[model samples]
Target: MKKITCPLRWILFLFCFPVVGSYVCAQDSVSVLFIGNSYTYVNDLPGTFGALAANLGKELTIDSKTNGGYTFQNHTTDPLTYSKIHSKPWDVVVIQGQSQEPSFPDVQVNTQTLPYAMQLSDSIWANNPCSNVMYYMTWGRQNGDSQWSEINTFEKMNTRLYHAYMRMADSSDRAMVSPVGRVWSYVRANYPLINLYNADESHPSLEGTYLAACTFYTSLFRESPSGSDYHPGIGAGEAWVLQNAAAAVILDSLDHFHLHPVDEPTQASFTLVQNGDTIQLTNTSSRATTYTWDFGDGQSAITEDAQHTFGGNGIYNVQLIASSSCNTDTFSIQVTTLGVHDHLFDGIKVKTSDEFIELTSSGGTFLIRTFSIDGKLLTEQSLSNKNPLMISRINQFQVLHLTDSGGFEKVIRIF
Candidate 1:
């Protein structure tokens, strides 16, 4: 799939060519299957998410099976949802319950939402161990749930909904929550001009759906959708409002909503600068209080930041272990100590824009290798005679090691 650079053209393309079920089964694509009620279907939340992904130059496949006013229990009992989970490998399976179901009392939610959520999560993991079960925490009714006397206001309803979804996610190993409802609360409180509710005061209006799409994009991709061009026919002005609203809620505190999958722990990230045979490691890990450094040469240090000198290195694996009360993670980098042979690329210039890595030089064939911050090689390509080479989809936070045939090397970090 070629990248679409123009936002307007991309929006046109999305409307002209609506994605079908057949279009979503592609190799190496990020596949998400949404299973829920009308909340997941109205304004085509999955389709909106697809457009948002395209805007960000990501290959995404979205498919949803939704029925009006259906609960998670109904979805668990339905065979189609089960078959879809088993039919193909999905990167994410988003589950949304009926609007009022999660806001109900503890006894009701425990007996209703929790059991069905667990059942659905088990089915998803059984089908694909890698699939992440995301609970779509939906919003309270526009006027609040009249049936539930204990939750008479939107604030109370959303509060209950938040706790219920959090409990559900915390109970399971593979489950996480996408706090779309919380984003709605923020929008409603701050942006009064943007009406999220429809005439019924329950289902989302177009703006509401757009906000939901932005929240999903942030939750699933772990990237903010603040400047995405795909607006799904909504005016650019309104789209901007919703996008900012989504970012303010989702990106401000991602851990509050449990956006990341349970098995994926916090990452240990650091920057390294080499001078002669000594290397300096700067610890920049998040949510970690302690650090352990391993130079991979029988030498290690227990500090947040340290300097290590190699005996006489060809290539050594340097590892950092960052830990907190909740999680522990390790990051490794292969550092090549060339003694006096380390020369900077004098004429080479490297830069990044959006997803592409742009390399510029007067002339020469260069070996460009992309690697994770941990030093795992991602791609190796030789650019011959091409003064500028642009590599796409290098969007994650990582390091790029560029070496020319003349042995000059440059290391750049993308964060």
Candidate 2:
């Protein structure tokens, strides 16, 4: 089978995209500090998240400065919270507010919640300028909050929570949201059988905490959690579904969240077109002066656009390094070329590049679904030969399952 590699897209604004910030791309040992209240403490959300990270082969040093009913305002005045912020050069700090306060009226939140959020975010950046501050976008009550007349349903409450958290995340130049709440909305819609609420209908149950952990894992790593083997108390199948929901929401549309605001480094990207044994390269890098290409077969080039014929038909990792005086960025993809018989699959042509997966059917309308190597659903759509479907936010490995209109099914692995 042939492979279409879609490299991760690094955007400057989100808290963590595929290749943004030094902390996000670190090889291992990501320190995360969660500062919240019962929502965080319930079911040990931080610990759950840490375990998920470790299961995925990333060591996440976890700590929390939490107290019951503590809001962002409460943390602002609390000395322990400030101490935690200054204690170490943490890679990421996740701060959450009292669940109800943010969903309140904007007039009240702008004063009581928003400013305090900005103050706390400012403190994180001031302590460690490289520290990535992520807002813990909490979920809504299972039912709506009866105390608020405007938010009388789950949807209303969640909408309020979403807007309120976005308000907090938007106020800072160097802050972004983990978006656990948005992921919760996805679970509620896609997997209603999973109860994310405690008996009180507010705090997270063990399963709910797992869902939140899954969300944070995807946010921090910019990858899917479906590959992990640990699920704690949740069933393996259910855990897989939760992990899928996290990836679908967090990774599929990461740019919708504000992740970073310090000056962006140069952005690097490129595309590949292969025919027979020769591969053509297109340099799409922005704000860069010099370029370097590694063909993975030991042959390399320095031009912005070049072509190379491989020694034989095999798999090779193609890499590009785009650099400027102040900074540099790199992107790589696995390229598989044939020494003869140039063909573009007359049935369907599926390709991935620059954070997107594009599928175009030539012969007929087909049902197409893409998955991670671990079998987590990434994108699903129906496209006739005329209209191609292009999805944003693709992972490193994808498995495409296709079904033609005549009811013929085929599965192809993409490397």
Candidate 3:
């Protein structure tokens, strides 16, 4: 019994709902903050979501700042919303846009919805660089929009909402979309007896909220909630249907929702080759496209490879920072060039070629080993009586530890 033609119009109602309420309960816990309108505050969606998380043996510290009919644009301007974002480092922040705003024309959505969504997202990252930004992806109005001609049906409105949410999530940071409307579409087609609409053919009935809660559970945990014993006021059979639909729509298509395949952290490391007061830096970082180096003398450079000269050397702590779109890593080392010159080690002649190092021993069985500055044993070999020893590729400024058969030691500094 979808809406045919209602006599009334409903748009933009503002009522800031407040609720009264954390523990180290489960092995997995997440802190989520919901910012939306009645769609989120009605059934206490955050509370319901927390209950579902606890039911599944996971913990959720849920909170919300909901005012009826709040839009993403409104949140962008509201001081209260900014305060909430800066309150703490939320593990995840769920942004829900106004019901009809996203379903409007594409131009309207791009102008009104997407930009503000991006603003909010930027704020989220600025506050906590590691926080995950998620869009709630509300369902279409139960009946449809009576005022608009193009989206006069539930199917049409739902499609537009999908597109808008997807656009918001398609940014470089890659936010997650819960796809609640997508799951709602599945249920309305498959489970008719469950009235998702309360009375005005809009907003969510208890069943609708439960359905949303199930959808969110799957979206957040990436697991099906079909067998959870805490269905609350709904029958187990009905709840199972909702959970399965969520699993089918979201769980089955996780990549579509941008949920799976967590972001890989940036890798940062480097090696140095020092010649007098000048040193050459080779970037060994991985999973990073950009790099920044701190020469520790109030000087810095943004490049993959760098050569910096110290002003009459002491010890310099050189650092390299490697970064990607969503991740950052840094590595640093202490380097000195006080007395860097050609030195003889136990009368063993050393020759340096482009990629290899050759060592000649004057008729003695000594062990030759190359080690990194951090004392890691890079390579080791026993030098037989008088044969020339050839060492494969080695970084400049690397240290070589030499010991005679009598266990006497000499250290040769090479660059």
Candidate 4:
């Protein structure tokens, strides 16, 4: 039996096109610091990200200044906390208040606390310059926890806290909020078994820890390694996807690559006759825009899709910059050549607009003469003439060629 295959173009069209969504790439390694309470420390929360990054061929290190029950106030007063941010460089510092801070009615808990986190964030940025700070918005406590009794409702408290943190991040623009709390809500809506609490119903279980890892990974890295096929086990594919997603997310988030539309080809592939030695450029962007071509020659630029000839051999860089109102992009290529020596003074052609009739060479100078088939002198001129020198004006065209100052001739025209 024979196997059948789908066309590659169709496959590429389906998978390669950009969707409305955006993702951050984590190509480079990341140094992360988690600043929080047991919610962050218990069950080795930071290791999950490190483990996942490793799966994706990334080296991720998670260090922290954590206390078992530290709140935003504790972190502000803790000398050890300040020391960690300054000790070494960090890519991101994850900061959060006590999970119950949002449940308070005074709102000053969040208002006062966010500033301290931001202060720490600023210090980190001042030190690292390129580091990003993220606030981890934790989930609501168990349905009947004592912390919620005075908060009126767990749901309302979590929502307000989430929004408070979001507002703080938005105002500063120096921090990003990872929506793990939202994902936790999303998972709980579908899966009743996803609750983290043991029978005591206060803390999370192994399953709960895994869920937290997934939420953090997805929001922070823009992809969840577990995918839609999520289950309880922590094995091969799950681990690999999680780690790679972390690397991809972190890398992409930091380095931005602005792209211009690719020049449309006459076809997916093209062939050019070797003589003309020019590649015609086209605007393939959806909108019309101006283009500038730097044919990689250290020469002047041309504004049109004109033909060019190479004088010698080797690779040359060709660069093009195109711009639209929305964005601008650049493209470059190196044109390599087979360097064989030859002289065109023997039989070269020239049948272009008079404005483009200049000869360039690396050797001897050239003179030009025009004549009829009957040897009647039509026009004779100095080959070195660099002005508006007119040639034959006959209607019945024949052949004309170019000659060197030494009288060697090349057929410049055959018509």
Q: What is the TM-score of each candidate against the true structure?
A: 0.59, 0.59, 0.61, 0.48
Q: Which ten residues in a row have the lowest lDDT in candidate 3?
A: 1-10
Model 3 lDDT tens row, 205-290: 88889889988889888898878777777788888898788898886677556674224324566756554467678775644679
Q: Which stretches of candidate 1 lie over 4 Å from their true place?
A: 1-28, 261-415
| Candidate 2 per-residue C-alpha lDDT over 1-415 given as tens digits, one digit per residue, 9 for 90 to 100 | 1111111321121223211111222244677888887778767788788778877788667778877667798899999888888879887888998878888888888888899998998898778766777889987788777766776678898988887887676566525688888999989998898888877777788889999999998888778899788899889998999999999887766655643222332445676655457666777664457999999999999999888889987899999998875367788877765443233334666575544667777766878887886888877888777788986643654466666666655655443
Predictions: Cα RMSD each: 17.8, 13.3, 17.0, 23.9
Model 1, 184-298: lDDT tens digits are 9999888888889877677788999999989888887777787888886678998988888778777756655556643453447676656557777777564456888999889
Report the alpha-carbon TM-score of model 1 versus the true structure. 0.59
Clashes of 1: 1
Report clash pairs, candidate 3: none
Candidate 3 TM-score to native: 0.61
Best by TM-score: 3
Model 1: lDDT equals: 0.74
